[model samples]
Target: MGLTVMMFTALGLCWGSNFIYMKLAADFTSPAQMTLLRVCCGFVPLVLVAWWRGALKRAQLRLLPHFLVMALLATAFYYFAIAKGTERLPSAVAGVLGGTIALFTTLASLVFLRSQRPSTAMLWGVLLGFAGVVVLIAPWQDGAAPLDKQGVFWMLGAAALFGGSYVYVCRFLAPHGLPALALVTWQMGLALVLLLLVTDTSGMGELLVHPRALAGVTFGLGFLGTGMAFLLYYALLERLGAVASAAATYLTPAVALVIGWANGEVVGPRELAAAGVILLGIALMQQGRDRSKVR
Candidate 1:
């Protein structure tokens, strides 16, 4: 109803549709090439915003090491790994695995941050989330085509990075009370530089020839998904606080599944059930850690 709520909802859609965009672009570009395009396109708006808000500061250069760490953890590896993962998996299935971010985040918190003690509900959530993943992958079925193993692992790895980035932010970045935009700007900037140097971008330009994939890459995936998404995330962090904002994870996979279905990717009862279980697991994990923030 309210503006923030609307923004929150829109954020989920933007992220969810990213998979569809990737699927559209897959035929034209390699995973690194696609990620390079995304990172480059996404960087423009973020830098502009940081400048407009006066969030960019020269002194922040002192935090270069942290920025690079975040660059790898959040932007570089996160995007590329997910792209690699999605390359082999269906958009809907990849999106579901991406939901594992919450599970890993909770696990990271339990292991890395002693401030929050492990609770019974949290442990159960871990189990439920794992079981959901197993069901989603369906290793038992040998006759029919099972989910791609490599893709699933890549997605899981990306999810782990996603989950770990939150802890990295909580432990290292949050203490400074730096403007979130500034930190992200620096992180993404470095990631862009790193990706440009390493990625072979020769054929990358070919993807832009396709109108749909082009629009999706420049706008859907880049401007909205990367740049604006972080802008929205920081805004939500300010308004909703961390725990509540993180709940957006719940909406993202569902939106991705719906979009995937509409886009003609296979969506059956098994995926739906797995999604429900994963969501429930996330709910339980969050419940266990509620109001238990570090003092």
Candidate 2:
């Protein structure tokens, strides 16, 4: 098959597997520690690529204010929050909830992004996306093995941050015309520093004692999920448009569900159905995205 196809498939696998990786490593590290390690490891490959390409500009320092915020929204907060959620919820469930990023982005765009108005289908997509979340959660049930509330909070918050970061970048950073690789490198670097400042490093080596845990962090969470996934995404964007290339919002959850099932997690039909609904909504939003206007 084509290189883009291979990269797209690999990237999806990496992102989908990330939830289970976090779940695996959750036994050994705090969410903070996990985020710290993921960012630290991921940053290495990114900076190297940026250096090789000479994408890192000295003048980009003028945009440090925006980069710092992007660091929080896109890197630090998003990763930490997902780790926190995955620590509590079943990996598949966390993955399903992740589909809401598109929903949040669509809504956030309508509100904050006047330049890009939503089409009729996009509004319907917002409604259906939320309805799918409700099905996923089923809050009305009286303790019928309902999903963890706190975990849902973290996952949804992460989804919102991930989704809204698009708008944030479009408004604040995209206008700068900095190299995408360079911007990502700086954003991740700042996030690494921010995470390092607040995250305690004690007991982090505990993963070394557990082979599975160490593999989860070193392979699945950091190198593949964080670092290599970013590079693959950039490659996909080169091959396909953003709307066509970005599939993790819905794709990873399916992989996560399959992997979760293989791991003996109880993924019933209800979760599968909810995931279907969310995916449908996301597809519509993507199809309906108003691309005529440039931010």
Candidate 3:
């Protein structure tokens, strides 16, 4: 249990800090290029790790189509949206908004997932979480800097795609008994290919000349955030189980807020209050939940 707790905390820290990495890299590259580079650089480690674990050898080629779709929804669209959104939003705000994926996931389940029904708590959680999102956006706030509507919309779209992808994973992929590493390996591989086609590489020469941007893309976003973070999250999902593993989402906002503050980003009271409300909603979503459903 202690190890589980530690892993869970580590997962939150890793994923939470990913927004900072994205923030660092976004300014240097186009969204498509940034996401492409992230997946491409991260791909090496994931492939090696999957091979080391014999996941590649054990994978079923029959599920390639599903993996392709998962790549589109989860990795391709997910990271692209985040990269574009991070360019326009504060890192902490993006991170807080990212956690709202859970709320979207629960709502999505109630619709497309036939076997799933909304619990009273989940319904309330959804409403409360939406309220928190509205407060976080605070469109009516008269201040020096209002929230970026474009950024908010992009992140919300990312969260929604993320939630829907998870539902597809729960319903389709998990039943196939594919190793998580193997799945991610293929997903990233496919995403890398697609991104390469759509992405402009004209900035590559300039980015190579800038060491900070290069390192941010190769090491910060690639290895630690994308490659290792996926491994850590999957480990937590296995050890803590899905519902409890979600505690990471609750813990991430604090990490993001602190990191963003240290990096000279503004952390206002309104943002903090919104995070608290979102946390409350997440807690309610998990309240007395059974293990029968995928989170």
Clashes of each: 0, 0, 0
Roughly what TM-score does model 1 have, to 2 decimal places?
Answer: 0.96
lDDT of prediction 3: 0.83
Deviation from native of the Cα of residue 169 in model 1, angstroms: 2.7
Give the Å error, residue 185, model 3: 1.7
lDDT of 1 by residue, 1-295 (tens): 3999898997898788888888888888888888888888888999999999999988888888999999977899899998888889999999999889899988888889877688888889988998999989988887988888999999999988878888888888888888888988898889999998999877766865788888887789889988888888888988989888988889878998999999899999999999999999999888877734431
Local error of candidate 1 at 151, Å?
0.4
lDDT of 3 at 231: 83
Q: Candidate 3 on 1-295: residue-level lDDT in tens?
A: 7887777777778778878877877767788888888898888888888888888853477888898898888999899998888889999999899889988888888888887877788778888988989988988877568888999999999999988887898888888777787889999989998888888898677787778878877787888778887887778777766666777778777888888888899998988999889989878877724533545
Candidate 2 lDDT over 43-153, as tens digits, reads 989999889989998899999999999998889999999999999999999988876887888788888888777787778878887888888888888848878899999
User: How do all the candidates rank in terms of lDDT, highest first?
Assistant: 1, 2, 3
Root-mean-square deviation of Cα positions for candidate 2 versus the true structure, in angstroms? 1.8
Positional deviation of residue 87's Cα in model 1 after best superposition, in angstroms = 1.0
TM-score, predicted candidate 2 vs. hidden true structure: 0.96
What are the lDDT figures for the candidates, one per model? 0.87, 0.86, 0.83
For residue 18, what is the lDDT in candidate 2?
91
In model 1, which regions exceed 4 Å deviation?
A: 291-295
